[model samples]
Target: MTQLNEKLTLKQIEAIIEEMSIDGALNKLYAFKEEYGTKVDKLIVKYEKKKLQWEKEFKRFEDMRRYEKEAYSEGVKYIAGIDEAGRGPLAGPVVAAAVILPENVFINGLNDSKKLSEKQREKLFSEITEKAVAYEVGIVDEKIIDELNILNATKVAMEIAVESLKVKPDLLLIDSVKLDSLKIPQKSIIKGDSLSISIAAASIIAKVTRDRLLEEMDSIYPEYGFKKHKGYGTKEHIEAIRKFGICPIHRVSFTKNFTL
Candidate 1:
């Protein structure tokens, strides 16, 4: 250690500290801290803070995996988490996603879609789809939402997502909703998106897919601000409906209240 420290410049040692794990860097840097004074002391403090923060985030991630771990213990090889978005939107389709992730897969900062910003949801959507063993989304349009009603339409969307999965899941972890149409074993966890990593991944996928559709509708209709609110019954959206009346994409059932 003494020989190597003598040969290496302080700048080079700092670079090494930056690259190595906090544990290893601490071991190597502590001896140098007294000699190097403030410079090395600062690096040690920085990475000690980083180490604590990382441990906190990693604990959150592992806690989110509780459901998946239980399923794996039961010999469930593939578990798909299902969640839906846009059921409350006044326009655009209800979208649901089914995602089967590898056992104990780690996605940094994963949580319920509603908890994330648009950019964060978009980033997680891409990463979830890419890493998932099988991922698929189902969309049921405004017309279907009017016909089947939001609850039924959402169920249909979930069924479609599950059916479309390339690799059939042995079990389904749904977010506060259950589809009895499917033969797969299932559990509905209230706020599952917050509780389960798989459900959170699906929530991100479904939300992003629905948001993209609304953005496309925005280009077509331009006046409703679908892109801005994603067709939810915001004050602006309601005002637009009153100003221009409903567009073709507006859910008749949802916007009927605006007309009355």
Candidate 2:
């Protein structure tokens, strides 16, 4: 076999690396290193780092699915994961999502919405919606949030989301809050979005849905920069509130401290 040398372009090596799975790519890189010690040195180092990253990510995804596996074992055919978004934002409605994913479903890069980049979350949002057995989103406007308080409003949204599911769930894996009103069996796991695949899917759905709403709100309240901060109380958002006063979408209770 001819040893690869400067005749082999870096781009060619990179393309080969991209086509293989993490383990396959790593093994091939190691073999290449053995054959052409310093010739493929840079490629070996790059793929070595990539292998570590892929391993860590795979472990995280495996851990996230533990809850779903347990539910599946216990004859829970449809397990819904529920989570909410926009709870802490100073503007926009609080949104909740309930998602029931197929048993043993695996989607690469699925994780808590907070742990993902915007682009990753967007990509996964579409994937989850398309692949889920059932999914529904519940949104409570700022008025309802202020009237009911964030906690109660979130509960209402969650319940609505659960009710909206086309496929009724046999079990509910909720993130940090159990709905007493819900007759379905449920487990409220703290940070379930990070610990449960279903909840992670719900978190992604809620986050993306609320973000899109806030983006539209940005058009109406251009002064608030909803598109940038997504209604979080950043210095810029607070400055906008102070400059333009509260918009119709601002949660009055949350913005009580502001002069508006």
Backbone clashes in model 2: 0
User: In model 2, what are the clashing residue pairs, if there are any?
Assistant: none
Off by over 4 Å in 2: 2-10, 26-38
Please state the error at residue 114 of candidate 2 in Å: 2.1
lDDT of 1 by residue, 87-205 (tens): 78888899999999999577888999999999989888888888899999999999999998999999999999999999989999999988999999999999999999999999999
lDDT value, candidate 1, whole model: 0.90
**Best candidate according to TM-score:** 1
Q: lDDT of each model, Cα atoms only?
A: 0.90, 0.91
- TM-scores for every candidate against the unseen true structure: 0.91, 0.86
Candidate 2 structure quality by residue, lDDT tens digits, 1-260: 36555466767767877889877887887776665677778887887788788788778888888888887888889999999999999999999999999886778899899999999999999899889999999999999999989999999999999999999999999999989999999999998888999999999999999999999988988988999999999999998888889989999999989863
